[model samples]
Target: MAQSFGTFDIAVLDGGQYDPRWPLIHMTPEEAVRAADDMGVKSMILTHVGKFCISAHSWDEPFNRVVEASQGKDFRLLTPKIGKPIRLDGAEQSFSRWWEDIN
Candidate 1:
């Protein structure tokens, strides 16, 4: 789908459960990152993190790891705070609205 669309950027919401049998509701963080990189996607943002990953108070760890893994590569990983705007110059893309409540 990315090839057909030729999209430069992609966002994965609730993507922390890559394994279908993991008893989680989303894709694994690593799998999501790898898939994005393999697809030649230039940027990826992870969302919909589950309570299990957050109650531990280290939800950002996995996010940071994905970002580090994509460093110096064509892919740029980001975890934007709700309501912040993200702009991509060459792509002419602007992501201004986040969650509705925050916006």
Candidate 2:
């Protein structure tokens, strides 16, 4: 979906990879960031996370990894709460690192 955008304002990507085998199916957090950076996306959102157990890592791993991987990178990662609204009017937005506090 995102790859075909050429250049876009935002990208909503799934931050999951069941395992190494499925990374090609769905991107890992790092891969998503790379893709967004390569595509020149200014803002990116990670969805389909903390809701599944396809991989061996912790549920918050994707969120944490994405944040780590995005440092000094070209895009902003938006981790919006479920069922919440995020204003996309080109205004810079900040979201709580909701996954980090988990035990």
User: Which prediction has the highest TM-score against the true structure?
Assistant: 2
Q: Estimate, for each residue in 32-90, the C-alpha lDDT of model 1 and write its tens digit.
A: 77678667777788775522453333544455556556667677665556556666554
| Candidate 1, residue 73: how far the Cα is off, in Å | 2.5
How displaced is residue 60 in candidate 2, in Å? Answer: 0.5
Regions of candidate 2 where Cα sits further than 4 Å from its true position: 1-6
For candidate 2, report its TM-score.
0.83
Error of 2 at 19 (Å): 0.6
* Backbone clash tally (model 2): 0
lDDT by residue for model 2 (1-103), tens:
4467666888898776447856567788888888788888878988668876867877788888999999998677888766678878977667898776666
Model 1, position 40, has a per-residue lDDT of: 74
Clash-forming residue pairs, model 1: 16-27, 17-26, 17-27, 17-28, 18-27, 18-28
